[model samples]
Target: MMSISPHQVISAFDEVPTVGHCLVACITITSVLYGLYQWLLPNPVPGIAFNLEATKSLFGDAPGMIKEVSVTGEFRVWCAKQVKKMDSPICQVFIRPFSKPWILLADFRESKDVLMRRKEFDKSSFLSDGMECMGSFHGIYPTGDKFKWNRQLIQDLMTTSFLNNHVGPAVYSKGLDVMKLFEMKMNLAKGRPFSVKKDFEYASLDVMIEFAFGKNWVHTATGPQVELLSKLGASEVKFDALDQPVSFPIAPIMDFLESVYEAPEIVEKTINAIMPKLQTWWWSKQSWYKKIFDEKERIMKEQVAIAVNNYRSGHVKTGIEHMLMREGARAEKEGREPDFGSEVFRDEMFGDIVGGHHTTSGAMMWLAKYLTDWPQIQSKLRLVLYETLSTAKEENRLFTFEEIRRAKLPYLDAVIEEMLRINAVTVTREALCDTTILGCPIKKGTQIFFVSNGPGFLSPSIPTDDSKRSETSRAAKLNDKWDETHDLTLFDPERWLVRKNNGEGLLEDDVDFDGAAGPQLAFGLGPRACWGRRLAHMETKTLIAMLVWNFRLLETPPALSSHAGFEGIARVPQQCYLRLSKI
Candidate 1:
């Protein structure tokens, strides 16, 4: 009700500073209010469980995670631990500051539902962002026309005929080289426990390189080891202690094999960045990155030229040749020339090499540890191999690809399944649109982490009723629950094997491996599952049969045999040592 005169207002305005000062003051106030609002705001999704402190800060869970990662050097396991910390099957964490919180779902039924039913979910932007460091045409891109095209291009490589005829034989032949390398190492170490992790990794890389480029492309990683050890005697290899790991001459960074191994590590680092695509751009500008990138490009160009020449000569033995053929077919269908040097072709081949090597190596590394720890299981597997491959055993020869593939070794299959389940890899997906999971609403573009090493997998599942799941999920339910009689945390292969009545009624104790008896997301699920699963199974089974048949994996010292593992693109054992004796 009080009226102010113009003179009084002028006097008050004169007390204030310049316009710039007033503007600065306004900005400061606005910023403070915005900060407060962000800090006080609740999680973006209502009714979903999250860390309480995250909702009270602008950065959310990122600071805590950065701290944890700095100390532990692990990201995937820490993500899984959040589910246990919250004591809920579904929980959210804000990893990317200012972006939407990531939902961590540990329940297999719901996670499977989301992955299997692709309408509500698709490959995460996180994947495409990570793969951006590689190229836009990499197969990990989100579900779309691009993904379909990339998949179709390499579809022939994964076919049953190609796998059995081409991949199986190549894997078996390379695995023999690995087994021989281990034998030479065992001799040099003089019964000492030594690291075989690199050997396994390199051997896998060799197989992948061959798989990608065909037998004519000579770039085996284990070739250097074979060359080195074939010349050196036991005393010539200089090592101090009998208990220590033997060191082989290091391969240079520019070496094609080593470069292939190191490139994926950079991709892993890039994806872990706050802004993955931006990080990739920054990395691309750096000299070190450029050097590797250039070297890989050079090699790929050479390989592509060789593959083209080979195809012209009617040589169709390699994956690249088959891909070129597929491209020709597609081009004919579309009424266009096949682009042999296309980014899509190059990216797919490189992506396959990177993806195939890391995952298979990780699995093989874990297999060595498990075999060393449980000799009984090892012995049982050996017995089965010997029984199933009796002709090879009687002839005292290595098992053939056909022999191993045709053999119905239930126990061996169980071991592989159990290992995959226990050490299942982490997978990511993004919501395609606004959707609900386990009765909780999920916003579009929300990144969801489906943990394979968490509840309903490595531990007892958090109880939930079927009524809470989506009607589609409930109707599509096919998997049975894990047998509650056994401890979930234990690594027992028998969990996958169940006695079944033979239709002929001749064998009452016949057992079959039931993959659906329990939860497993090792290869993920549905349309976007691991593309190389069949190849992985074939390679793993053959390698295991060969290794167990060739040598008795002796137990290692506790210090050398620690089960502690560090998670990267794959969860690899901190220590993978083998003490072997010839069978």
Candidate 2:
């Protein structure tokens, strides 16, 4: 039904009218029906409704709100501002009549209820079917049982235990590489402003190579002198020393991953989703893509070959090794032959790697900015690190994964939480069946967005249900409850620290994951939440600690301050600049 074009629908409607009088009568009836729909159809969760035609119109047609949403992660910040003013915790937003009405929820409890309960909400096919992406594309678009099997297979690699051994040292080593590179760049610039954007991007990709492969693959630039598989989309990797070079075919593999992540829009998605074979046939004809896919296949073969060799040898700790072993286990369990060397296996391993690598690295940009804008918090953080990691500092060594995890640094914890809150994406889910949230009916097929950043993250305190209290006093109470000492919008980690024992610090446990959107949700909620979250936190925490202990982020560079970042699936800060003398 969806595959049928609008022109065909219009033509069918024209055929409904037999003659001139009949055509006039049919037009009147259609107009009346549309008017009735406008009048009825439950008032969409009320706030400042969008004037799509006036603001979004080109020559004059609603270009849709998704263009903005798809292009920038910052749109959620704007959404955060709008939904906060609505009367209820959940609001409804419709971009166009053809599109599903977006159920926007500010209440974290409701978000959890929907996200956690798979019976009620399954991940909408928008990312896959809506985008016309082929198949459930492994680490890309998730669907059905294949997703479950793949997720289960890769689950161990992303776990806190596995990553603690694998990721911590790799991230620390890469983080140091970045620090040294930045120090050199600062020295060369003298007093001029220098950017840390390249450092973040390259360090992230570099870290991934070690984390994913576990064995030597490609060793590109570590400082300013070398090119990071330059033909690949990555910016540049700088070299601190001229040394070892690891050879690996990196470009085609990374190119495919990049292309998959950045899928086409609604129209193309619809056509491609409905007619995948034809779509595939057409896409394969493109010479550029043919080369890309061929290269991708070659890279996958190389990866498998290396992973198999590593397994045969004693060096079997890599993510690829974990995946390959799991595939073997599954074959024994299911009474079928082991299936390796397939696209499915490739997607699961590479997809998880890319997801963990890019998102985790992207998060550093936001954390850096927050630290730069709030130097006092940075100072306090350094104190905590020095006290907690004093042994490591004196020993001239990196803190172990356990030490980083178990350290009594609530301020650092709070700072990390606060950064995640202000910059996290509001997750979306589609109703698999008819569901009701907080008494509001969510029809089956409805697409809902859990606005985690609004009341849950930034608000700090949500409204108390007391109909007797006036809105003004309630507003005052919210201000008093959530933000008594500072502007909630500013980068303030102090807000997360509350009195515990004799000192102030983060709540006793992972407070962010609270159903109400305190610190818990940047990764997501429930069983289906991000498997890589713990590893992400550990890696970022290690990097942040290393950077803070070594240097102070003095002031935000003008370019950085205005940086809205790469407004996409993840809102990555494009640049982070600081003028510093090594401590």
Which one wins on lDDT?
Answer: 1
For all candidates in order, the CA lDDT equals 0.82, 0.60
Q: RMSD to the native, candidate 2?
A: 9.7
Q: What is the TM-score of each candidate against the true structure?
A: 0.92, 0.75
Question: Please, what are the lDDT tens digits per residue for candidate 1 over residues 450-492?
Answer: 9877778887888876788888778884655467557877778
The local lDDT score (0 to 100) that residue 436 gets in candidate 1 is: 87
* Model 1 lDDT-worst window of ten: 501-510
lDDT of candidate 2 over 1-583, digit per residue (tens): 3498899999998777468878788889999987776664434433323333332222111233455545553557656755765545666655434444566777654465556644677665543443332332453344467777877667677676677788777777787787776665555444445566656766776666677676546643353322322333322433222211212232222554434333322224342233444565676688765665565456666887788777658566877788778877788899998767677765555555555655776788788877777777788788778777879888877676577767766667677777776667767677778756665667888867777667656664455344423333233312223542355557776666655455443334322322222444677776657767777777788888878888777674464465465533455775666655577
Candidate 2 — worst ten consecutive residues by lDDT sum?
239-248
The per-prediction tally of clashing pairs is 0, 14
Off by over 4 Å in 1: 1-31, 34-44, 239-242, 251-254, 501-509
